[model samples]
Target: MTVLPNNLVFRSITGPEELELFNRLPYVQNDELADDLARGRRRPSWMWMALDGDRLLARLSWWCRPQDDAPFLLDLIDVDDSAHDVDRCAVAEQLLRTANAALFPDGVPVAQGTPPPEFLRFVPADWRADESTRRMVEDRVRAVERSGAVPLVERLRYEWFAGYPVPRPSDRLRFRGIESTEDILGLMARALDGTLDAHDRLDLQERSAEEVAAANFADEFANYDTPRTWWRVATLPDGEPVGFVIPARNAYHPIIAYIAVLPEHRGHGYIDDLLAEGTRVLAEEGVPNIRAATDVGNVPMAKAFERAGYDTISAVVNLTWEK
Candidate 1:
């Protein structure tokens, strides 16, 4: 049996020390991300690293579910900054080939970017997003292309933060917590007619708009640690619904789940209140920080996030694979 380079040991680990080492690297190291893996919310077969003796050198990961053998998702990948003497690309390739050797033995592995599912609903209808995600979209393409497969779609990322906060909403708005899915979905269905969600866009293309709305509810909004009661719906004192904000924890962070208003309600600034209430709810939950992202061009919604005190954490570039 031919082994990998003797000097460098490549494998997966469940040890705290190794996990700590992986979390300390630059560029792709995220404590929350590492936490997800360590918590068994994500699996280790999809995560791997390259070590030289006791010193760490290169790393690669696939972000996928535990039930699957081939990790269609790729996560963090890094090389020791000081390893200038070693070919980084070679090590990266080795890591890719190593994973592909087993998980995708019968065919090539092609990767594209898909933002974590929870975020899709928040972007606006006209925003042209771009992800250009580094490893999953970029590295995956290079890795598979080397094996003769190709990526088929554009993996794009977009962002807005404190630098572009929306102005405070008009005084005509009052905020209230949501208690029922029926109420939330009503606002969402109307919002979807003008939303930027790619999945909904694809779904509505094939399924009835009503069915798309129902599936969207089950897939995204229905599951949350913070109840829909924490959601803030903006409305007129007379009871006309304007917009709403979801400050709830999905499978991961406290997210701005959905923020939308009727067309007639646009331009009056109900979003700021909605955004503020959402962030405040998450901050109260005791998480050190919250994460939210919006479309690059959803001027109004993007502005609301800024006004509400959330900062731009990072840009997540998303791409998807082809069948």
Candidate 2:
């Protein structure tokens, strides 16, 4: 454990039994901590805390694919809001710096390059208009910034309840179950062209579209245990491929994992058809909720979700150490 000047000590939780102590500053992931730990998506060593005596002042945790041994996302970070005199942001920054060094001593992971794990924080949809909420979020952002991470993207998160009206499938295009993984890979690579997604665009800077598509497939799309038959490719009546959608239940919720209109098929409102098909598939499965996200700047996607009866429930900001 590292001791700080203000009698604060930083260290990882001793074990799953210490989760209650770590949950002092509540967040959305509180309920999943136990399951995540048991399922191997989280490890005690990846969960760190900065404590003032017996009080939990700040906490940071990373999550990863259950089958993978390395951290995939730095998803949870929080500081006690009620601790009036504490420099909470500073505490968070220090905790992040210490944990990151211990987590990535070699400065890189073999699968993902430098700063493999990116920080993701969920905030209220109108966080900026709410002073307390804004402060709570911005403080964490500033702390991560202080630890050498830069804001990469801010995405609008949406949710669709079972009762929400899903659009009728398009008459212009027909949807079919994915024929094979190679087919989806080909379309994913093609969709990267003219992509407005912040994450995809960032990756395209250093990697080819095919390489990025393959990486996404291996790291995410292929990892979900949900039925692969739920994936669909939308093709024109003439049998020309337009786009595709993957509706799958991830570790948490049933989600429209991906939807895209091919570069050549853009400007025809085909995205709506793709999204609707994805939502319809999940709703038919009797899922209570379906969730999806798109970059805040991707107006077309945001509008499509709104038109399809999905509500903007929150926003997620992703930050990463400068590569």
Candidate 3:
């Protein structure tokens, strides 16, 4: 428990009896909370809130995959929107610092996902042009920063709907099902050589590229609820591998789990072909929407998603705290 100003108290939910109290905060949907609890992605002890005489002032929660003993990310942090900016920031910073210290004493790296751009649009006009919304977002970010977290990268979330016009397949490359885990792992290694992925780049600072690639492979495979047959490798006429794509369903929806262009084949514009094949796979399955995300700074990949007719639905900001 944490002691706060004015006799405020910070504590975790004791059990299922506090579900309504946990869901009372804005931002998270009640149904989503119920689903997460039912699936074991969330636990009562992982949800913490700061209260001033039963009034919720701030809250933070961690989410993990089903059956995981430890949380993988801190996905939600909310402060009362009506509070003064300074007060809101103070509550947020204190809540995060104290909760993190208690929940992650070993200093595990925890990640935070900002609400998607569309979700943040409380008013109808463009959110980017909305000053009030922008300031509120910045304040939330600063609060996280005050807790010693750093911005890892900004990401673009894209969605392809059933009715959208999918790009015609490019004849420059041919696609085939992934033949073996070893071959896919090999391509993953090659994909990291000159990767533009911010997370991959950050990991490379202290670990070998191969080690980082292996870690990524394991993490990604763990979340894939769909069949491995959905994975594909793109190649040229001479049977040279150009790239690979993992079009699979995650815990919730169909997603382009991973897509990459080989370092040697990157500049040749083979990514568009890979994107097309990945989209076609999900589109052919009649999925209502296919979601994918790329680092905001990865212009080429972002352009490829756009060229494939995926809409830029939102932007996700990731803040990380590492031991």
Number of the top-ranking candidate, with TM-score as the measure: 2
- lDDT string, candidate 1, 1-323, tens digits: 22345688778766555667765555534556666666554566656778778777777666643333335356555665556666555676687567656545554543433322111111122233535223223443354445433432222222223333333445767888775778777777777776665555656677776677677777567655566677888888997888787766666555666667766677666666666666666556565556666555466766666556555544443333433
Each candidate's TM vs. the true structure?
Answer: 0.67, 0.95, 0.88
Candidate 2 lDDT score at position 310: 93
**What TM-score should be assigned to candidate 1?**
0.67
Model 2 global lDDT (CA atoms, 0 to 1): 0.90
Quote the positional error of residue 310 for candidate 3 in Å: 1.1
* Pairs in clash, predicted candidate 2: none
Count of clashing residue pairs in every prediction: 16, 0, 0
Query: In terms of TM-score, how similar is model 3 to the real structure?
Result: 0.88
Per residue, candidate 3 scores C-alpha lDDT tens digits across 250-315 of 777899999999998878888888888888888888899999998878999999998888888777
Which of the numbered candidates is closest to the native, going by highest lDDT? 2
Instruction: Give the 10-residue window scoring lowest on summed lDDT in candidate 3.
Output: 116-125
